[model samples]
Target: MTPTALTPPLMTPAQRKLGMVLCLVTIVLAVLDMNIVSAATVPIVRDLDPVHGVDRLPWLVSAFALAATALLPLYGKLCDLYGAKRVLLGAVGTFLLGSGLCGAAQSMDQLIAFRALQGIGGGGLMSVTMVVVAHLKDPEDRGAGRGGAMGGIVAGLGMAIGPLVGALFTDHLSWRWIFYVNLPLGLLVLVGAALVLKLPATAGRRSLDFLGAALAAAFATTLLLVTEWGGKDYAWTSPEILGLAAVAVVTLVLFLWRQATAAEPVLPLSLFRIRVVRLGFAVQGLVGMGMTGSIMYVMLYLQIARDVAPTTASLYLIPMAAGMTAIGLLVGRLTSRGHSPRTFLVAGAACATLALVLLGLSGPTTGLWAVCAELALLGCGLGQLIGQLITLVQEAAPAHQLGVATTGIRFFQTLGSALGAALFGTLLARVFEAGEPGEPLGAVRSLAGAAREHALGSFTDAVDVVFLSAGGVLGLVLLLAVRLRATEAAAGVGEEDRPVLAA
Candidate 1:
């Protein structure tokens, strides 16, 4: 059941080398744009509309994140219909266009709109790159799922370094440079892809499921809005959030119905019947959920509690990035020696869980090195899980459904990240409030001496609770990962329970 090692026989060494570089660059452009703005928001607000921009700051992030997440399913279907090369090139062109627009924007409103446009293409960058990888794999590499393995490592590196990269750009040049940088990088890569990358076309022409795409988009949009706006912009029970939630529920039901009945469904419901497919989706979601606490909240802890500057706090992510990069490389080598991906999956969940527990136990007195160590451990777990799960599902997926299966992993993870942000954010606020009654979490910044110390302690405790809760979720992920059978033979032993592999 293990994927055999790949021999680089598909193309000349130079062509493969160039193609790989292009893939990595495209992926960085996509994933980095997701978080890079967080570090430069202050400068952006100051330059655009000092007073009003502060109020609308979150939209800078939400615009990209929401648009990117909502369009993922459609992008996958587009790849299937139009071929990955055509779709990927289009996405790059669109992204570059949006980046240029963003750089030239004179107002915050214009920037936000441009960001949405950027996300339209950014949506396809990460997911579609993997599809391209699948297409680019050698005939001998069939079922290796090694395609996503490198994707995971690069993605982890991108995520860890995003804020730091943003800070460096904003501090050294201009906030707009962050947007401008993508132009040259993307343009060069697009040209290289045109020349060096050779990929397969679609099996045949098929009708585009416009209605299914619309319904699915509606569901994802409303659900993301519910998560983003709830508790912060509006009360959970407020009409706006409630209205969005209702629409999300309604559209979800409709989307499911459409998937079941439509002849050319955008997302085929039958894919869920495959055991690895189902497990992969679920595991990726939980990983996203846990990441809200591990990645985002760690920055909060450093900046608010430890009084580190934002840029400096971002530097702290290096250990985690290093761990992800190191472990990811090691896994590729180990798997090449014919180890099952499940071995790493289970081990990764356990490692991440242990890391979360270590993070949860940290307090104000906890040394900075200790925190870094915990993060490294977490990264080790993530490196093992992120790409390996994709590889597993990819290897197991029926060839005809490759695009859908690939995108589904990312879709669930994005949705889970949204939900996790909402849940952990509320939990942190509530727990901190309980510790320091009638005090806002931000009040710790103003308090001095004893009061400040007390508030910081409370805030620390709240963060700890979040880490522990995330750890608990990873623990659940561990159990689920354990349920994953090592081989189709194991699953096929019971005909009634065996996964339906028919596309």
Candidate 2:
């Protein structure tokens, strides 16, 4: 039973406006959760491990990335098969529940599990928002409504003040407050999306491609597992690493093959055949790897390396946020004039790569202003590309399949983000250990006024090494940018799937 046209329009104007507001709030809550935890890492480790063994610590970040990436496409398909309004409301509910669990966590393992639970919701928050926005308007208006909405979402007041917000939660309130903070906001979004977001009914009996979902999840888990444990939990040459890597390769290949043939496939293979979707996803993957991976490290360097207080460290990040907002608005304006998105993609990737390379070479004594400038450049590059790609992906896709297609773009990028963090974090720890004075952990623990400052000198060098490596990755993203064309983006969806609603 294919869906009938239950509503004259796919969604109401009022619903669209309210949904956008709710979506923006979700992005803020989600992004804040990602960074706020970083500030709590050292303190949580100290409280749990007076002996200072941090073997299980990486799970805090890794779990969230893994769950979010794995669930992204899952939730996206749900939105397409069921309805965005239903899925969005469910996601917010789950996010609230997970947040409560995180606040109550008593052990490291419990916290990791709870965080992963939160990520399941976070995945829906991101993927559904894009689809819902696309459903609100015609393809021509996407840049103004969807792209502008995304820019505003990122440039929103909460994200603009995120570092400061996180610092406040970490400094005065308990670190648990960071997780608890989402409760009120999540509830608000839940209500808004449920009541105001009405979409065309999806009347068909949905058949999820379970085999494809399982294989994709298996592949993602295996890849992340090897990256997470390869250097830390076990030696890279160990059986565990080799076995996991092999399993990941086999499973991913199997997933691809299954997608090729499955009826009602989880990931429509035809999407990759569309030049815009392929190129857009490729650039987004590389950029996401570099940007998200480097986010926490940059903050760590500012607070630990430069010896700034949490408040001051958060304050310094304002410049980057400002740069992103400013550039994002400018690019948003450009999109209205029918400007080619390719130039922006290539230039943004190039600028980001340049900034990463420069920052990677900076030393402990490097001027604060200089570091800030490079960060601003990086932000500028990211702002120019982020909203543009998201909007383009949505535009290229047909209305009925928008959710699944958009989620694919986000999925690849998020997988890259996980790999980046795990790899870079392991490298940072190893380098810091090698360079530390005798009883390095103890020495770091004992330092007083400038204790974090002295410790950061070692961290600065390590971060530089990571940044340089990330720059190389961004080069590939730049190449993909050249392959993007407006015509390709316009043809991202198939002729058959172009309906405004499932009906």
Candidate 3:
């Protein structure tokens, strides 16, 4: 606690700004790589299996989702133990290696394996980047630089540009170029990480909990498979559904028991003691469920129901991103001033609910402008919630437990997405089975020149059902948001964590 120890080896303001910019660039690279591969699937499928017999197309996406979500906690724990810089650099290296493998894949199986590898790297990037941000300043100033660099630049730009960038590359160059795009970005991030990111090594006397990790993976895989395949590939009542549900229950219960007794558990059971963390996680889950269900169906409606081309449909997402970016930046400023976060969550969830209802009301008769308006509203609601929630989680928790706390919130978010897809998918299947007054699918089949028209009509009906369901869920989230508390972190906590250079 001496003055010399408290003093940072000084750097100029410009130097610190440069360091922060470089670190954020790493976040953008990781996030861009996360969702870009979706646009390259057509080229990959055509080259690897032109006949289209392989049913693993969805798996290519799902494999990455499962790997990334499941490994979040693992990487977060490693970051806390080994130092964020080392873990982040290692993850970036893995990501670059995976990207190279994906570009060179000769078959669908190879591509999927490579994508899984990419996810392993990506999982670490998201968690550790946030942790680095948390470590940069005491709780007070943590939310300041985050608005531009972390939230708007990294998350907003990455989410918006991913499909657009991927489309451009896949169209003009080659599908492989989408994967190849990561090389320069990843290399640059590696250099920035090596030079600027610094943290004291702090691995405690805990064994790596490999058993807990395997069990957690099993639980997540079973749940995801049940969600993905149930009601779509097989009946919900079938043996496959029942078996997977049983496995999920058993594995999750076993993991929970192991955590309760483990001397140093991977996911510490004690972190949930904070009421704010508990409520924040619950709100995160609900928001995730509503958002994912709504977005997926909207995309489906655009492409299948409206008959918009993939490139055009991707462009339509601009309103959502734009709205989110505007509101997210605004909220970041307000929340940094110690504004009550609960109010923002409630207002945002209400906005989302209203947007979903508007989408439901539109039916097939809605114009493109009307649909875009609805998307914009939903995006605005999301802006107030997403970036703010992560910042709140870090500020509310004890410093050393920051990684696990953030990972827990992320786990719930992933769970919500999986559940939303499964639940909404079931609703769509039921709506199809019940059918409208007329046979919509058959009418589409019977149409000669009107095939696309009737298909669009059926999609309209499905969207009506799905969006209405999402609206109801968001309304519930609004109610839950009322119970969430905005914890006031102590003043001067910021100086304790300030870095020599911006982390």
Candidate 4:
């Protein structure tokens, strides 16, 4: 939003606090929906359409991610045109509506469709909440991109706990409650928004690139479909996969062309000119992919490969959160004593990469404590890198373009996670099929003694490849992290506003 757009009223300190709390709640809602479904997938499939749902299960995850990611750039632009307050409330209401529909879905197709609808709302929750946050802060206190460093930590924490929450609901109540529970929480946030939020309104003045938004969403959706279906659902060379790939490439070219020519592009290509912004986008995307690998696949590893129950598997995240908390405290002191944020980034990436390597080296028979240690190390790495990347990007961007720049990095991150889910799914299926020929990963449940053990081993080995691939990607993030240069754009922030990740 334009800084001068209808100068916001002076809100009391209490009101500001309430507003910030509401924003965090929205973050929780978005991040939880992204993750909470994973733990309950088995039950949902069994109840919905067990016959064909097994083959379409990945869609349950991918549909939300794709729909959430597809319109991200446009959401940023919308916040610029309309105020954050209106956009945020609209998103929350839509998400609540979608949640209700998801709870009532009767078939796998219905559930996936509802998830996409929910994602249409979930898309706005994360990005727009940050926009609201920027408006809520005191002008002097306001830093970059809605002061998103802190939100990143909150998001990471939510990602850690979502499965546990999902497991608890699925264990004690039912999987449908996962979506139903959002209703009360979302309604509370809506009330808070209505009561306390004090933000500028800017609807009539800005030029929105409607066509540009359409092309961007089309490109992203097609790309994800190609990734999700290629080599697994269809042969890589088959007409279906080939046609999707062709559509993806053409849509991408058209989107780029439109962005170049549009009056107000959804994502301005000029932001990429800034080195910090460019590298930060790559860092966030790789981090998103790594986080997805760690959080999503770990449950699969524990539940299927090791035969652990879902609730017990979710408890394992406690170690990861503990590690992040410990490292966050240590980094707080080090940065205060005069350390570089870039130093932390490099160190964090190295640690996370090493942790992935350690995880990749493990087998189904590995001890629980040993795997926990690796998760803790991974958490330590992530705690350092996640929040700092966006803070750096927003600081580097020009103030007027803050909304798109902030949302743009998040857009890439969500896109990365979506692609990772699809790509990793394909890899897992192919590797498992190669070793067992005809047996699917799900067949381990029905096999006896030796066959079950062999299937579990093969599945674990396939998961190992996913971790190894993620590790190699993080190794690249480490390289980019090293290339970070200190600049005046970032130097403007006060010590209080700088590198709040550790704080």
Best by TM-score: 1
Error of 1 at 481 (Å): 1.2
Q: What TM-score would candidate 4 get against the native?
A: 0.84
Q: Which stretches of candidate 3 lie over 4 Å from their true place?
A: 1-16, 138-140, 143-149, 336-343, 436-459, 486-503
Off by over 4 Å in 4: 1-9, 42-57, 106-110, 138-149, 170-174, 201-204, 300-311, 325-343, 422-463, 486-503
Per-model lDDT: 0.83, 0.73, 0.73, 0.78
Ranking of predictions according to lDDT: 1, 4, 3, 2
Give a tens-digit lDDT track for model 3, residues 1-503: 11111111243445446556766777777768766877877787888887762578987888778788878777766665666667788888998998899899898889889989888887777767777665554333554435322464355567799888888899999989998988988888888767765554454544577777777778888998899889878889999999999999999999999888876566777666665667678878887889877888888778666668877887777898888778777766676676655567778888999999998887766799999999999888876666556766665665556667767777788888889988988887568656444454435434556655655566577779889999998888887666554233322233443222223
For 111-222, candidate 4 gives per-residue lDDT tens digits of 9999999998999988888767765765444333233335545655776788888989999999999999999999999988987887765547578898999998998888
Q: Which numbered prediction scores highest in lDDT against the true structure? A: 1
Shift of residue 407 alpha carbon in model 3, Å: 1.7
Error of 1 at 78 (Å): 1.4
TM-score of each prediction: 0.92, 0.83, 0.88, 0.84
Q: Write the per-residue lDDT of candidate 1 for residues 1-503, one digit (tens) a residue.
A: 32222222446756766787788899888768876888888999999999888999888888888888888888888877777778889889989999999999999999999999998888888888887776565554544546555765786788788877888999999999999989999998789888877665456867878888899889988988998899988999999999999999999999999999988787888778887788889889998999876898998999998898876888888888888888878877777666778888898999999999999998888999999999899988988888777777766665556677788899999889989999999999999999999999877999999999999999999999999999999998898888885535467333432223311
Query: Model 2: per-residue lDDT, tens digit, 212-281?
Result: 8888888988888887787767988899899999999999899989989988677788777666777778
Quantify how close model 1 is to the true structure by its C-alpha RMSD in Å: 3.6
How many pairs collide in each candidate, listed in order?
0, 1, 1, 0
Q: Is candidate 3 or candidate 4 better by lDDT?
A: 4
Better of 1 and 4 by lDDT: 1
For model 4, what is the error of residue 346's alpha carbon versus the real structure, in angstroms, after optimal superposition?
2.8
In candidate 1, stretches whose alpha carbon ends up further than 4 angstroms from where it belongs are: 1-14, 143-145, 486-489, 492-503
